[model samples]
Target: MLIFLSLYFLNDIFAFSGSQDLCGYCFDTLVNSFDKRNSILSPSFKNEQHPIFVTWKKKGQLRGCIGTFSPLPLHSGLQEYALISAKRDDRFRPISVSEVPDLDVTVSIMHSFEQASRWDDWKVGVHGIRVSLNDGTSIYSATYLPEVMSELGWNQEQAIESCLQKGGYRGKLNDRIKAQVQVTRYQTSISKMDYQEYIQWRKAKLTSIRGDL
Candidate 1:
């Protein structure tokens, strides 16, 4: 069975709809099916905004990460982006199907992109950041959580460097599209379950939860 994306990033994508009280378990089946994803792109609330970053991990080691600095079209919503981060990031090796069983996915929901008006607002942990320069290009990076700074032991320079390196920032500062950004980052995680097992589990859960009797 392909334990590919089952239960990955469920918590991060669904947290804002708290009153709905949706759990990650449920999200495994009930995806954020909105094709024109409002939250991940141009969010309805101030907290949700464009150019967000996503990172994935399995058994506490880095797996994958990908995001945008400028607002990507909502058509490329979280579902697609999450999958891209999983199988496509070049940082580490591609996540093998074997690593699926022990994996866990964590996601960071970043705040609105703000130009670096004041460098002080940029805290390594508390901020999910984007850094860019003059041409028409930009960078994007986010952590699994605000605590990642302490856990990773990174300072601002390291964080900035990371955003630059990992997020595909190319060329000199005076070149490309120049822009400095910061975000109030929030995060969430979901236990990675077997993809086939999750599918079966969901069929059972839905039948039991949304019972006809």
Candidate 2:
């Protein structure tokens, strides 16, 4: 299991329709990082804060995935995490520039958090879950994004148990442990862009800029 910490706070819900432009910004950030140049594109969205996750895939397989539970300004946060997920995810080696063309990026903006009555109280596909367990010695925490449960075909119990293991809990699983778990459920609006699509978007943006000039 990949190890990543998860934490959140209750806040007023904000409207965000995950946009292709957001994913384009991520791609631009990453390519610039690889080239050791500053990003040439600015995010067009408002600079509102939200809990965001950036996930990278290569040829339909998980290459890297990382994000923050804390709210962060959209522009800087996406810029920061685009590189972090690609270059800093410890589950895999740093993504090389050569691999950029084969990669697809997904940006998930998380919102609508609610405390679950029980570990299984939330809908599987609709909610991303964060689970925390205190076993009288230490607290273990982990999260799965909203798309994860449906993608993996996991029931609520299975997802919770898997999240526990991902959080580095080696203890026995029983009613006692399940009863002790604290669960927070949330949702995300996501946008995905493949490398080719990113390239096309970049070209169109440049064309539009030249036309205006």
Candidate 3:
């Protein structure tokens, strides 16, 4: 019975929709994003837009992270963000196809972006913060995803300061600095998979198909 339950859970991992696991679209994008290809595996996602961030990590360090606040169709958004995050993130060098085998992909589907009453209004682990401030000349903004604070063991002030620094602010962080900022708190539903997991799922799927023949 234990073996059967374990297999049952493994079967669920390979199943795509509503499972919070990487879907076929993610694997397809991982391949096509570097090839400059434009084909999509399934167009079943809604035509409406959903704000998304694609993150790539190699050996548990950040390789790339880029996305948009503007909502776009999930099909195109996933593909576009995947490539952009992998290759175009200005903070790091481009990811090569050779790095694919060691990579982990995380898709963050963002929602409920609400203007926070203050910088400290949101909870650390629950909210992803997007902060913008005009320091006399131009507006600067940066965002950190929900898991960032919890993962880094950052308090609310530390998280906000880090985000401010990310936005290109080199000025002193103080109550005055905090007062001018417009903070929007959001949430994300994330799905992730590593390359080895993807390969395993592919093998399992193929084996299942062959067994049925």
Candidate 4:
């Protein structure tokens, strides 16, 4: 399970209203990092281990996206990857503190991984596919999140072919190469929040805490 970054913007058709708290926690972590603070306001959710991804967008464009397939403790994992994806995704420059106010954050929790029967076995919009290709001496691998297919309007075969190319496969896309591809399919529960929403959520949370106190 390797960490990969995607530049694709999530399709508008899919709605991710799962966990604002999760996205809030990610935003908190990033804001703290930018401010040189070590303290994080505890998240309002239970800590559990899950394979997670953190994605950042600026004005609906991809800023950074990265995550791992390994299950990790939610609190620490979110905190870690929140910064990693925002600042370390090599495809784009590191996100600055100034960018924080304009960014949107998304958190994806991946699960139900199954080995596909064939390269084209996975569903287009339902499953995120990871492809591994071995071209005799070298091995290449990459993954696209579930929304990618629908956003790009690709059928199963096209999605697989795109994934092969994404995995750094430079060889021909003949049947032999396609036949040798190993695919693993997984699904994700996603949550998203924009910077303004984060501020509002934080304000409401603080007000609630104060009232309780």
Candidate 5:
């Protein structure tokens, strides 16, 4: 039977939400260098859509952190950002496959985004902040995830200033600049994966495949 169906309908049939074990998918992505857009992921990992940040670290030092504010299917979002953070983050050189053995990947699922009533309206350790400023000619914007402030031991003011600097602002960051910026705060749910975790996940997958065969 031939029937016409809307993309939205297909999306509704596919999209899902809630707790997920994402380590396996990420491990497969790295091992096979697979594109998530074309890869098969567990339905549990693709049920809901959200804005996501993919962070990579080695020895507790930041290797890369990149994400989108725009919501996307969780599977595609994680896969796209995983590769992007590992290879395309301008602040650091691309992470090689050799480095993958020691890399730790953290996936932050963003939600509850709301505009701040004031620059300091959000909590320092509980909310991620995104700030934008216009100097009448150009607009500059940047974001710091919630963990950034607590990890760096920064107060709200310091975090805001650092975000401004990240936005490529060269001028002094004062109350005036802070006043002119629009601030948005958000919260996230985080999942982390280490090399050992990836290995265990891979072994399980291989076992499953062998049993199926």
Candidate 6:
């Protein structure tokens, strides 16, 4: 039988309250390139999603931002990739020890990819995005916008332009061969910076609430 089913991720609608492990897991995933999404996901808490976008900010300015598109890669889901993206997106390097004290993190739980051929497909403050061409040879990613580019002093055009430039489109932006743009959306659990004692607290909480780890 051709069995089929519809699946959904409910991490965004209801998040784990009280304990800050999800925030910590997302932060750990952003800070360290270690795959710990599963171990970090608390079954008792009931949210089982990984690789959410982790954006770092200080005051009202952007510090660093990064995450994975798909749930990392099974054993090593978004946990490792997100951290790598934040620290090594090339736009900015990993947060340094000096800058650590003045940063915050936002974890955006991502959705699947969607292609936009019509201009109507675009929207502000919604839709995380990926533009690709040459059969996936070229690609550019942006998860949760307005914030990402706005922080970089970019308008909508500038953001898409940057993507186009980085996307390696041999022709101009208005080239006859239109782009194969893939858009993905995510829900973020943004928390204020809680560096001091956050990790230690998480370690204790995870073990206490859910002994699986």
Of the candidates shown, which would achieve the greatest lDDT relative to the real structure? 2
lDDT of 1 by residue, 1-213 (tens): 111212343343455433111123222312333222312222222233334445566667777766654444333444556666776776677666566555544434343333445333566645544443323354454333345666789886665556555556544332122234442333332223334544454466556756755
Question: In candidate 4, what are the lDDT values of residues 43-153, reduced to their tens digit?
Answer: 877666677899999998899999988777788999999999999999999999898889999898876677888887889889999899988898999998997688789
lDDT of 4 at 83: 92
Better of 2 and 4 by TM-score: 2
TM values, all candidates: 0.52, 0.91, 0.81, 0.88, 0.83, 0.59
Task: Choose 1 or 2, whichever is better by TM-score.
Answer: 2
Local error of candidate 1 at residue 19 (angstroms) = 9.9
Q: Encode model 6's per-residue lDDT on 1-213: one tens digit a residue.
A: 001100344433244323355456555554443333424533233435444555666555666666654443322444554455557767776666565445555555544334555422555455444554443555543334434654576654455656656655555545333434443333333334455545565667666767643
The C-alpha RMSD in Å for every predicted model, in order, reads: 10.8, 4.4, 9.0, 5.9, 7.0, 6.5
Query: Best candidate per TM-score, number?
Result: 2
Q: Which residue ranges in model 2 land beyond 4 Å of their true spot?
A: 1-15, 36-38
Query: Order the candidates by TM-score, highest first — what do you get?
Result: 2, 4, 5, 3, 6, 1
Candidate 4: lDDT of 13?
Answer: 8
Clashes of each: 9, 0, 1, 0, 3, 2
Which clashing pairs does model 2 show?
none
lDDT of 5 at 79: 71
Residue 135 of model 5 has an lDDT of 83
What lDDT tens digits, residue by residue, belong to model 5 across residues 66-93? 9987767767777788778888999999
Tell me which of candidates 2 and 3 scores higher on lDDT.
Answer: 2
lDDT (0 to 1) per candidate: 0.44, 0.85, 0.75, 0.82, 0.73, 0.48
Q: Which pairs in model 3 have colliding backbones?
A: 49-72
Clashing pairs in 6: 72-77, 72-78
Model 2 error, position 63 (Å): 1.0
Q: List the residue pairs that clash in candidate 4.
A: none
The count of backbone overlaps in candidate 2 is: 0
